[model samples]
Target: MRFFALWNPFVFVGYDIASKQQIKETVRELYSSKPHLTATIGFSFAGLSAALSGAVWTGAVATLIVLACMMFRVWMEHHFRARSSEDVGEKWVRLFVFGSLLSGFGWGLSGALLLYGTSAETQAITMGIACAILQGAAGRAYMTPGTALINISLVIGQMSIGAFAEGNYIYVPAFLLYFTFLASFIQQMVDNRLRQLNAEQTAERLFREITEKNELLRIANERLATKAYEDPLTGLANRRKFDLALAESLAASNDTGSTISLMMIDVDHFKAFNDTYGHQSGDECLQLIARAIGSSLAGRDSLVARYGGEEFVVIVRGEAPDMAIAIAERICLAVRLTSLDSLPSAPPRQTISIGLVSSRAGTPETREAMLAAADAALYKAKKGGRNRVCVHRGPCPGQQQEQDTVVPFDAAKQA
Candidate 1:
């Protein structure tokens, strides 16, 4: 068990670093291999030109041999690509080194062999050297640093030494300047590659951070939304959320032509209970009653909410009047039987009055109307003596009032 826990396959084991290294090496080989063919073709053109420009046919045959060597290297590269990915890195490096050495030596030999202290020989050698340097720098852009540097040196070094021996003072300085230019260009490419790599790393880090922050923000927003509608004391839907839900329910019922039901429950003599037992006990009692009410009305479609003080509300759909009344009776019985033995000395036997009202939609009935109907039923239960259930149809008992108290609407039915 301990070993399995430590090496859990469902969790965070990884080879992240090795995976990135493999990716980098594969890309490096790919880039380096592609440029080799282009470089080989450029050097071959220069080789053929130098040999054909000479008076002796020996330079021509030598250039043909060099071209053949370059062609063989290109064919080898094509075959290299057919190997498996794991084998590519080593084989690619070996091929790059061989190709560089072969092409470098070929150009260098042509420069030495073709030069004869004549004006035409000087011109031919100069053209070949210039072409070699330019093509090397441009076409070998993706080669390894060591290979590029060595190849450039070999191609120009022998020719430069041979040019000065012909007694042209300017040739030595010119060769030195050309080598200096090549060195500077190589250094620039290295610097650019380094800078690009740094920039890419920084961008990757920033993107990861931004993604993490966005995910955190999404989770935080979800928490805020849940809290916004929940009552802190009972962990039930608060009055504000209840109102919104009731309105939406009413609208949906109206559209679907279904009956929308609501039950408004008030603890019997709640004010007197709170006056005798302090507000804290009253709050605890309400929480217990709310929980009982919720459990009694358990289903996916019904919603139970704390409707301020000791008043609780329930909204349900897809129920006839019989089903709705049965649920309300269950809530009343549950509240009556709820255990209060754990708390301090208080009302051991408590009861609740539930006012039930349901509206067959498409009657232009508003949420306020449904609530007024439920409140009216609740009033009848309180007036006719508490601990009972009252159901209201669509009629207002507006004129019959007890002193300053308002009469509830829809006071036609009681259970």
Candidate 2:
């Protein structure tokens, strides 16, 4: 029976881990419906026994006592069901009154049978059946603790009657005491099991909640990290991330004797375009240009970042000066291919100028020097004409001028 009671494998641990208020509400629901069933069962069995036995007066008295006890039990159960924990003291008092009355009636029935000179066997059988019925009814009324107590009590009463029949009156009290203690022990075991089950369920629920919270937090952290390194408008690496990547690339090149190239690209006539087409359209143009530049150099070690308004930067690792210049030409061509008609009231065409610089193999230089060299080349490209690529070949310390230049791409020739 205990195994069956504890054998629910699918018990929800989450419910046990609920707040105190929630647990109380659930207990109330479970307890509220049980007492009525117990009361009905008690009254039905009492009526049946009264009709079965030939002792009409005893049967009638027993029936009345059971009916009164059932009424009191139902009333007290209902009262407790409706009452808060704070009000349970009075409700328990009522329950104790009903229990005492029932116990006293059992004692009276035993004495009355003894006084009437009834056969001990008949008295034992009748009282045993009555006790069994009452215990079964009690099992239906209370929870595990109360049910254990009631059943053990019934077992003790049955044994005491047998002892009395054997004329071992001295042993009867001891047997009763033994069963009473046994009932308490059983009740304690049941309570312990209940507590264990509740604890396991609560732990399972907490684990699930914690797992879900961690998953949510992980996703939130990822989004935050992405936003931190990414430019919101162009969806490219921001200046901070670009600078870090540049520094790392420079360090690796310095250590491994590899070459790194940098490109500074500025949209030609961007201020004019922004003036012709409002700031919103200017933003659209920048987005279009960013996409073109990003598509042109999709190498694993290449990085594109928006340096600021109307300016972008690209870092190319392990590339020669000619290869870097070629990539810049492709970017220039890609930008020209993209239609700028979408820009509101814009000219028929738009273009960008790129300045490319490669780091020397033996000479180590700061990031600022490399950027300055590229900017000088960019100034040369703008001075000659926009929409062209210029490579920086000047000495790092002085003399800023492009050693070589590529002509601006003609839109008509782009077929």
Among the numbered candidates, top lDDT falls to 1
The lDDT per prediction is: 0.66, 0.64
Query: RMSD per prediction, one decimal?
Result: 9.0, 13.9
**lDDT score, candidate 2, position 352:** 89
Give one digit per residue, the lDDT tens place, for model 1 in 1-415: 1222322212111122224564446434533434545544544554455555554354464456556666766676666655666453444556656765676676666554444343564455455545555555533332244455566667667666656665655666776787667766655555555456566777888999999999999999999998999998888998889989998988888888887789988888889988888788888888888888889978737988888878888998879867888888878888888888766775676788878887754554677777777888888888877788888865423423333222232222331
- Where does candidate 1 have its weakest 10-residue lDDT segment? 6-15
User: Residue 213 in candidate 1 has what lDDT?
Assistant: 100
After TM-score superposition, the amount by which residue 74's alpha carbon in candidate 2 deviates from its true location, in angstroms, is 46
Question: What would the per-residue lDDT of candidate 2 be over residues 306-326, giving only the tens digit for each residue?
Answer: 998898999999988678777
Residue 221's lDDT in candidate 1: 97
Judged by whole-model lDDT over C-alpha atoms, candidate 1 comes out at 0.66
| Per-prediction TM-score to the true structure, in the order listed | 0.76, 0.58
Worst 10 residues of 2 by lDDT: 5-14
